[model samples]
Target: MNRTAPRPSSLACDECRKKHLKCDSTTPPCTRCTNESLLCSYTPSRRGYRRRKTPWDSAKTAAAQKTPQHGGTSTSSFVLGDMDLNQSLPLKPGDTTPPAPSGSGIVPSDAAVFSAEAPTDTPQTIATNRSVELTRQEEERLVHLYYTHFHATAPILVPRKRYATQAYPAHLKAVVHFIGSHYTPAFDSNLLHDAVEVLLSPPQESTLHTTQALLLLSIAQHARAYHVNALATLSRATEMAIELQLHSRDAPVRYGGLDPLLQESVKRTWWEVYCIEGYLAAVHRQPSFRCNSVSLEALLPCEENAYRDGLEEPQSITLDQYDARFFADHSVAFSSACYRIEAIRILARVLALTAATVDGPDDIQSVDNAIVAWKLHLPDDKATAIDRCGDVDQMMLQAFAFMHTATVFLHFPRSELLLRVPTATDIECASAMVPASPTSAQHATKAIVASKELSDLAALPVNKYSPVFTCALVFGCIVQLSACSAHAHSCIVQHRDRVALMTGALKSLRRHWPVAGQALRKLNTIASGIFNPAQSKQSGTSSPTTHDSGIGMDATMGDLCWFDLFPPRNGTEDFTMFGTAHDIWPS
Candidate 1:
């Protein structure tokens, strides 16, 4: 009988055997042979498969072959491996053996098993897909958590215990992380407002230390928003800081380590609070609201009470001495605070000017002088002192300059200043009086010319500084400048003679724009209707009016003329110089 010769028992690796290739029976599968579709063989018995001597092994195999209890094809063997034979199988009682492969009726050795019976798809592939899906779901969950936790309501309320125990710390950390890592100019303003409100709200006696710290941080951020009420928020934060300091003295110091960054951040917040309080007090007309001498003194560090030689000596001091020695110790914190305060002050002055509330030429001149003095004291380099006095010094100088320019504009009108173009003789006289220092001379000349022009403009009915009118004028100027550089250049050239004669005026005026934008918005709200000249009847006539002997119509035109020199920028179209113009206009 010509029977088919028994198929040679191939000793291929399980992978190769499954592909139906010939076996080489090597220790490891041969890469070349596998690539060529030949059997990348191994001694199957010596590989992963071992002889099963235990009853557990037999039962595990049987269990693996049975339909899975979870209602799917059996895949447990692939995941669990040949644990039973190894005596490491964590099997329950009554487990069954896996079925032997069909046709051959020969149970494949563990090495021959290659992979567990795949369930329509590979586990690795399924795991990869599951991981991807899980990650996407996690991201969506985080976003939902953020919105629900932070932005769902105007003022979210938590149970006092819950807030103290959990919510405060979590939210504060979230906000800090967000501010530290993901700050952008476009976040919702209400987020900051709500955060401030929550932080400032009185805490219960049971509030956690962590909660208090977070509240302080939130308050600090709120104060830094540069909004109309930011100063108020900062003031409250300072009070809380004092409370924290007192609280810390009694509490055990438990932070894992002293974080210099966190310390610096806290100090900065305190400094800002002090500065805003000081500046607001200095500028506001209301006596009750003004910062007092005691407050100002408090803003400075307490004098060290060290005993000297036989006599207790009162040290001779310069402003620099106070800044360098006393304030210097807290320079980083104090200076950051000072910068914010000065920035706000400068902005406020600028708004006052844009609103045309400045009283007279003298007022404008005084502000100019203050700016010059402050500028003289400014440090020329990056402020690195411990107290960072240099930064505050610079901010003060800049603030002074901004205020000076604003005062001049507020007190004067534009058209009158333009008409008072300086004569050749006037320019010569002004140039001859220039100071020896190049920087001083440049600044002085700019200031003088700007002041003179502003004074001249103040004399014109068209140059009136009513809040509404000023807003329109400033916005119009910004828009005009922004739209056409040629127009700006022409305006500058036309007023060059007057600008040159005033000495240091143009430079000073130009420097104030950034600061002035803030003030302009405030004033616009104060005098909204006045900005629209078309909306209001002419005060008397559009014609420029002559003033006292010292101030001519030309002089007034010179003052007003400063407004016409610069054009607005392309992206600044949305910025109305007098955003608050409607507020102050007669009802």
Candidate 2:
């Protein structure tokens, strides 16, 4: 075979590059390449060639090339206040008539322009209407209720500025009223649904205002048992965040080109979507959207004050760094908002992997490590206190509850999964027998512990994270009760405490979330069986008791809504989508 002699070149040969070896700048074949009979080629010098641009780079370039709209100004330069009066119309859902005049009726000339803009009213137009139904004082009250209750955690709405003359979108105002009313007795269920209908008309180009309004609307819908609409609204919110590229690291640099505060708000909005989607997935028992730690390039939100004060150069840290210390330590390095965001990020990761059945021991270990690290470095002052009932304090407490809930969720198997396995040892007697392995028992123990911790926290007022924590805490309590039943003789010490904790948590949760009410009823039925063994069987199985006493017909029987111990009769609804209003809460 003929061998080519090596020639000197500026670049390494393909063979050397593949081997990760020092190249002698050989052109024909390096000595190793020639000796090994391998193909050796150098990349040609590129005096004329241009490097390919990435999709993001192209997007940036295209954005730069676009002409300024509404004069020689970028889109970011336009504030909510600068919107044209001709665009205002407050159409109701499904109403075709031109919407009722927003705020003050548009001036005659502006009215003609509005008519020219659209002769016929559509749902989108209704969303943009600035008609102020509430008086200034009433509006201020509603706004106060919102800021007092939700603004801290959600923080989607912009802060009110003194002497500013901006027209707030009708849908945005409706959403605020809807959410604020939930905590107050002034609003009923209809008010919440009506608020959602405002945003449901149609999504309008995913502006920051629209996204914030839609997100809050989704939460309200979710709380109102409108799960399908909640999911749909959330999907739209997520799309808006993505369209804005809030997921990218340079999102601040790109989207915040002019207003850094707007950029920070965008980051929080994206993560808020991230957190919501994750919890929604767990509740729906489906695969989560792809907003994991790896895919997330944006920074975890800075402190609330930082965003509010419009700090010139907002400092930020990655979720990993936040988890490492920023979230756990409070030495002015992090905020409650950051803690909430980070907690959800972790929960999202755990739920995403576990739902897909892709989580292995290492993944579980990673979650455990993060939780342990957080607990180890948790600030002493920020600890969960029973007396702290303020909104911010309650949020702090709820964050801790969510962390525990995530732990229980990670380790606990779904009821359907367990039901299908059909262990020879009865579930009612699970504590009597040793688990298949030590690891399994360890997981169960950890889950029970987390559940108790969450239950303890549920003693306080419900926070937004309450719904998720409520479900997890109840599940944990049931598991603990079952264990006590299984080992009746050995687990006597904490049996009363476990029962009280489960009942208390359920009662507390029911006061705020309707779903908790259903869980409470089911728990009461199960509790009846476990506590009153004389009237039933020692094992709390669905099997009918023997009725050894042989009751007379004179005794009046009470109504009992038996919880179906069996898994779903059909596959249409399983443990995955178990919590929806239609499905009813499963065991």
Candidate 3:
């Protein structure tokens, strides 16, 4: 420190000095500033003159850099900052970048629509760089698809009524995007964001927009495999409905302030959210908002046309009486859509209690009994089994799938499962001796029979409309595949056909859901190992050795699965599937 005198810097301006470069103190702009178009300054002793360039200069510079020069030719060139850029140069045949269409609202950017994440262009990403203002026809098509394919299964919104209205709400807009995105391969999160924004905004009317929006958001998130976010969005929606007392039988159905049609819509909306929360809980193997109690004794939603016409009103039934009355109504008056909702509700309870085996056998038996009773009470003509009747609507099929899948899920791991089971159970507990006798192979055959029905459904060309198609197919395949794997030598069923059924269904679903794709890839490796163990061993295909559920299996069996239903015990201390198992659902 004592010997050093500071060296003088050659650079003059702050920009040059920052870069640690030598500077020529020219009177005009310095070479660095001139070349880079950065501001130039000199010392206090002298003034500087800087050349000004028009916006056209910047445009020309950008165009020249971006456009390829195959031949020495001049075409019309125009400034891009003010308008869409155009170049008169005749582009060669194989040009990758195309000019923006007039009024396209697209902005030039570094990010390509067909990026590495998606090598091929998709309908969603076709206008990625553009601001999308959905046309009337496009909206109609999307909404129609939703009504035709989704309404029967979901039935949250009065599509016919909502469609006829002039006043469009944000939640409706959100639903449009949600449905559209399913058919669209490359989804954009911004559309989801706009939906959330509108949903979260403070309400000004009696319309159930917020709740509907939240429900749609949850559905979109779930379909796209954003499970955690979907759960959170669902929670918010559930809370909103709770605040509105939408679940209460006594709450006024208001359109604006007091519209009965609006009331019906609200009723449907609340139940839909209830059903969604339950479905999410079942799929993820977690606790959901227990609707069995909570003083929410609202009657199930009526038919859509009935609600719209204000032609029907459901008779009020107490919580205790709900099951008997609901299940008994197999008549034309019952809303099949609502019937599906109740079925899903029952499913959610089963998953919450039996999924991780956090509860005892009594809890399992109770729910199992309920499921059995539900099946028994089901109208024989309406579809007690997969092929009982001809020409079933998509909604009824969904109900059947849910009912069957719930049965398989309830008995899983409790009875000796033969095929790929989700990794959500405590194997040590599962293996533990219990009082009830283990179900014999004949008893377990119930799952096999139900699974066959799912296989038949899988073969249907319009199987996509059934919302529970994937869940049922996945669970059913697990049963069949497990049975085949456990008794490969003794199994009479065609192993190849069963494998094909599972893999194909999963592949079809994978196009829309990444989770399905992941499951499919996993199932493929497992099937390969099972069918050709010698080849699999030689090829060195890696199968998961450890089960997430802590269930241990032999190496020879290849890979078995168990979806992680419960979070780690220490991870969530306060979690409960509502209160005690006794308080879950009414008998």
Q: Each candidate's root-mean-square deviation in Å? A: 28.3, 20.2, 18.1
- Tens digits of per-residue lDDT, candidate 3, 140-200, equal 6666666655665566665565554423343455465556556554555445443333233
Runs in model 2 deviating more than 4 A are 1-133, 160-167, 250-261, 305-313, 323-332, 355-363, 379-395, 414-435, 463-468, 489-513, 532-582, 585-587
Question: By lDDT, is 2 or 3 better?
Answer: 2
The lDDT per prediction is 0.29, 0.52, 0.50
**lDDT by residue for model 2 (1-587), tens:** 99997643346665565444656765687777888898876643212101233454345445544644211222321111221222223343222222222221111111111221452244344433322234445456667777765676566555545112223444566677666665666545453444336334442555656666777776665655555556556666666666666788877656445556656766777777777766666555444454453377788776666566665775677767764564443454566666666666677666555544333677678888887666766666555533234443534565676677677666655222232122212334333222344476666667667766766665555544435455555555555544543343445457547667767766765655666677677666555554554454433343332232221111111222111221121223233211232334421
Q: Predicted candidate 1: what Cα RMSD to the true structure?
A: 28.3
The alpha-carbon deviation from the true structure for residue 104 of candidate 1, after best TM-score superposition, in angstroms, is: 95
| Candidate with the greatest lDDT versus the true structure | 2
Provide the lDDT at 44 for model 2: 35
Candidate 3 residue-pair clash tally: 13
Candidate 3 residue spans exceeding 4 A from truth:
1-131, 184-207, 255-261, 288-293, 304-322, 325-333, 352-364, 384-391, 418-437, 440-443, 463-468, 490-496, 542-587
Cα TM-score per model: 0.31, 0.62, 0.62
